[model samples]
Target chain A: EDKVVQSPLSLVVHEGDTVTLNCSYEVTNFRSLLWYKQEKKAPTFLFMLTSSGIEKKSGRLSSILDKKELSSILNITATQTGDSAIYLCAHQETSGSRLTFGEGTQLTVNP
Target chain B: AAGVIQSPRHLIKEKRETATLKCYPIPRHDTVYWYQQGPGQDPQFLISFYEKMQSDKGSIPDRFSAQQFSDYHSELNMSSLELGDSALYFCASSRSGNIQYFGAGTRLSVL
Candidate 1:
């Protein structure tokens, strides 16, 4: 059974702190891993990592995939109150685009 | 900068009632995927269409049906709804089958 697990289900941090969220998956024929940020109603795409040893970054957010370990980590630097949201990680198999998602990490950045 | 579009942001229905949800993919996107997210649960894959054809399916209930039209828009029809069917239904579009962009989800409440 393919499954994705995220640790530290909920976290609270003061502004300007750095936080790391972890996700590990076990799937057959894994193709890619994706990250999303869900706020009030919708989830917005964040990053998609298909290779190991390479980090994908957007401003203060970055993520890296460790294919050998079947895991990934998302790092948020200089967190702000506006960054508070649920972070989701998903795995997509090579056979199809169907996604298996992880229970998200709820990060509340306090000012 | 176009994004996937969903209609009827909120709907309230009673048990045994039927509801229809619509999704319009981003222009030129060839694949569309549907997901159901229960309260505090990870999004679950329901179904997907590629180029107006049923390409994949997931844990969707038998009471639910979906289709993609020539214009690449899709609809999910659910019948005999139960309390368990209440969830946030999200639509996502991807041009290359890997990275998916999601739309604002439709929230369904069953009483």
Candidate 2:
């Protein structure tokens, strides 16, 4: 079975702190890895990484994939209370469009 | 830009009843995917369609059936509903081989 594991299931950080969320996967025919932020209702798309080493970034949020280690990390700099939410990591295999997701990391950015 | 749309934001049903969830993909998107997320759990892939055809499936119960229409809309029909089936069902859409965008999701509660 394909599995995705995320570390530090929950975290509490104050404003201006930098946090890193980790995800490791064991999947067959891996194609891509995606990140999402879930607030209250649905998950919003964050980033999609296919190649290793190259980091994808958006403002204070960034992510990098390490295929050699079978892991990925999402970094958030200068965190704010608005960043408090569940961060999800998902894997997409080459054989299908379906996504396999990790249990997610619940991040609480304190003021 | 238009995003994926789902109907009946919330639903309540009794055991053994049936429910239908609908999804309208973003205009011009060619693929749609379905996922189920239980309380405090990550989203699990259920099924997917491409160009109005079933393209992939994963972990979907036998009592659940889904199909994409000619207009690119999809519907998930679940029968013999149980309390365990109560969860947030999300519909996602994307251009083939692109990042998937998710809908607001339909929360189903079975009593």
Candidate 3:
């Protein structure tokens, strides 16, 4: 069965700290891995990683995929209170766009 | 244009009643998917319509059904609402090769 698992389901950190959230997926014909951050009603897209050894970055947030290991990691630097949200990782198969998502990691950045 | 739109931002219904949730996919997209998210849980796939056809369904119960119109607008029908069915329902639309855009979900409470 295809599955995605995220570790450290909940985390609390002080502002300016760097945190790493992990996601490992076992999918068939994996096409890409994507990340999302959800704070309110809708979840916003973050990054899509389709290759290993390459990192996708947006400001203080970046993610890398390890296709060899069938895993990915999202790193947030200089975390702020506004970044306190659920970070989700999903795997997309090549055949279809239906995404399989992991149980998100709830991050609390305290000031 | 609006990305994705959903109706009844919140709904409260009594047990044994029926509820209808609506979704208008992104104007240019051809696929619509429904997901349910309980408090502090990952969004679970329910059903999807793509290319004006019923694509697939997840592990949702039989009481839940979905339909898609020729215009790609979709509706999710839940019969005999149960307290366990209370959660936030989200509508998402995506083009064949694009990332999904989600609507502000409707929070349903079964009393």
Clash number for every model? Answer: 0, 0, 0
lDDT of 3 by residue, A1-111 (tens): 789999889999999999999999987678888899999878878998886568999999999998788899999999999999999998878534677889999999999
- Give the winner by DockQ: 1
lDDT by residue (A1-111, candidate 1, tens digit) is 899999889999999999999999988777889999999977899998986568999999999999889999999999999999999999988634888899999999999
Judging by DockQ, tell me the better candidate of 2 and 3: 2
List fnat, each candidate: 0.77, 0.74, 0.41
Q: Name the better of 2 and 3 by lDDT.
A: 2
Pairs with steric clashes in candidate 2 = none
Could you tell me the C-alpha RMSD of candidate 2 in Å? 1.1
Deviation of model 1 at B76, angstroms: 0.1
Model 1 residue pairs with clashes? none
Ranking by DockQ: 1, 2, 3
> Worst ten-residue run, lDDT, model 2 chain B?
B92-101
Where in model 2 is the C-alpha error above 4 Å?
none
Which residue segments of model 3 deviate by more than 4 Å?
A: none
* Interface Cα RMSD in Å, per prediction: 1.6, 1.7, 1.6
Each prediction's DockQ? 0.74, 0.72, 0.58
